[model samples]
Target: MSTVVYLDRISKAYEKKIAVKDLSLQIDSGVMFGLLGPNGAGKTSSIRMMIGITMPDSGTVNLFGQPFTRESLKRVGYLPEERGLYKKMKVMDQLVFMGELRGLDPAVAGRRAHDWCERLQILDAVQKKTEELSKGMQQKIQFIATLLHDPELIIMDEPFSGLDPVNATLLQDTLIDLKKAGKAILFSTHRMDQVEKLCDAICLINGGQAVLAGGMREIKSRYERNRVLLNFEGDNSFLQHPAIADYKDYGGQAEIQLKPHANAQDLLREAVQKATIYKFELVEPSLEEIFIRTVGEKVDA
Candidate 1:
């Protein structure tokens, strides 16, 4: 796939502090990409550069295979982490105004805004002032504004905040639909679970640098610990065997890590002989666990 967004040796710094340091990334077309990191890790600064909100102090940003320019901004939709709406304006009117800013005709914007409000199950709030609606409804309204312009690339920062489970799922489904339509989407968030579910690729940053970046499955497989979780219907004394490098008992089940030199078959054979092993399968680390391990190790050292 062709690159939709590319950052080459991008560096952004304040007067006395470096916010992002020599970061480079390539985001491809028709994929959902995630930019993840802890607070103050420069995820926001990097994204700001991508969308032209701020320029990199050095290096280049390319959007949609061209040099970043004012015209390119029309093809992009941005939902910032700090959401704002015209509190006194009716929901539909505000959405239409936002769409117009993105180059849509006023009539077209109004029609699209109404359609989106209905589709998002907030038709009743069409005429209500934005401040009159609940926070979740306002969030949906902002999301509608983001889509009403029909941009090719949608950039969302913390899209799930202030949303209930049902609404969050609704937004997830909407994003999936957009992906199916071949729109390149990038969202920055701290919610690892959502990233695990929705993103095709991810770039994890720490202290202003990209620490991990790749296809989710590929990244997890690379970090595999070669361990298995097992549950048996008998005594758990076999977990103490020397063949198990790391073992922990959790209620009726045990998580076992075999030594790199030891054969997994030997351990399974011993466990089967001693107990009726019910669950036995290699386990991959969760994104949260991987994040903790990756960053924690650096901090500890």
Candidate 2:
């Protein structure tokens, strides 16, 4: 339950533009935290500061409950969205080098490199040059490099990028296993739905500021569950009811977002009269919906 990474009142600006403004967030041991934002929202900038890739103009970064320093980074694993590998180097050699850079000895680094490739099902590619491997395989290599030194805090930016479903799921399971092992994990990704299922807490940034931040359940609870999902095979006249704010009808299915202070039970009664309801359920706003709503509102303002 100890804090693993903390950023207090961090601010970063590039020339005339601000990248992060008074941003603050914390991650605790055994927790998976999501850093979310639309393009140019400062998620990447904030993450860079967390790992000391760039210093914030003003603010503090504490890693592993201590003041930020290069030594602390040895206990922190980072995989940036932009992957780097020696094109001419063999997969195993490249991995070993990356491991050593993170403080492993040559023998230990090579051993861990081979072990990870086998566990990740990429052992065959060990002898091949990094340039010859597919993007997905190279990504797996980078993932191994991140864990080479057995870091306690893992930070990944777009970890699932360019991966097939099977490989993506493989990485997801690995991250979950790490969390169970008491490592604090932070990830920034555009895949909101996946984050919704995987992250325990989230900080949503817009225009370099955190517009929403909290435990997932607490944040979702603040929003009204006035959305209705209807599965019917007949007339869809209920979608036009006065209580319905907006709706999307796809043949036998309809997704309805109710107006403010709208009564869903009243709308359901009307829906039953027009269509033979096969399934009717009211559900909370998904993370995706909330992301759009919050970011859209910020943009409009």
Candidate 3:
């Protein structure tokens, strides 16, 4: 099926507090869909419902073209933000156990676990017990366990948590490769820059409701690029142009914010004539900017 995960007007609440309200989105194979929001924005609740960990108070969830079921979970792999490895168990054994629980044969599970460890650069720690490994190492072990059975729909919540830059990059590259191999991935993280770099589509949830959802290009295209980056060696008189709303000058560099319906081309023309322009280009609103503007609050990310 083209759609891997579908949430149709789903809502969830606790006691008298609303967690999520009428949230909806879709994930398709071969794309890393980012689930984004500020803290307590209903991301965790939505995910719990999506994976059958909790039922939604209203609406429906579909997985792999069918209604979500306990059995359907076998086709999905999840690595939650909370680590749950058995501290006493050897890393290799833990991964194999998780794989078997997902219905993989023991031998196959062991083989796949070994390969994943090597790929994740954690093979040397295979025989070590979970407690002996560093947090980063244990995190990699958990990552390996999540993928050991080779699931079709992969859900990683804060996957980069507790990982070093080098290891985080390794996991990111591996996820990209899995996406290329037709695995549907849903990434939930606070890192907007990483989301912008890794995801083609995104859903920004605030107060458990989807404030924005669409392909990255389509969503970004909807916002006007009113910010400009200019590097010049001469007079910065262009910063005072009528089109300019405000500006920040840093020596030869400047960040100019334009007024609504202002013409960037008009400002560029003025800048070129007034200074020896080294770099003159309009900068699009970053995902972080879009997030803050949409929710009207600063995201913890």
Give the alpha-carbon lDDT of every model.
0.88, 0.93, 0.91
Cα lDDT tens digits, model 1, 58-164, are 99999989999989988888999999899999987888888888888999999998888888899988989988999999999999988888888899999999999
Query: Over all chains combined, what TM-score does candidate 3 have?
Result: 0.92
**lDDT score, candidate 2:** 0.93
Cα TM-score per model: 0.89, 0.96, 0.92
- As for lDDT, the candidate ahead, 1 or 3, is 3
Q: List the candidate numbers ranked by lDDT, top first.
A: 2, 3, 1
- Report the C-alpha displacement of residue 186, candidate 1, in angstroms: 0.9
- Whole-model lDDT, model 3: 0.91
Worst ten-residue run, lDDT, model 2? 94-103
The sequence of per-residue lDDT tens digits that candidate 3 reaches over residues 1-301 is 3899999999988999999999999999998999999999999898999998999998999999999989998888999998899999998888889888989999999999999988888889999999999999998888888888789999999999988899999999999999999999998999998899999899999888898999998999999999988889988888889999889999999988889889999988988888898988887889998988888853432
Error of 2 at 144 (Å): 1.2
lDDT of 2 at 281: 94
**Higher-scoring candidate on TM-score, 1 or 2:** 2
CA lDDT of 127 in candidate 3? 97
Top TM-score prediction, candidate number: 2
TM-score of 2: 0.96
Judged by lDDT, which candidate is best?
Answer: 2
lDDT by residue for model 2 (135-213), tens: 9998999999999998999999999998999999999999999999999999999999889989999999999999999
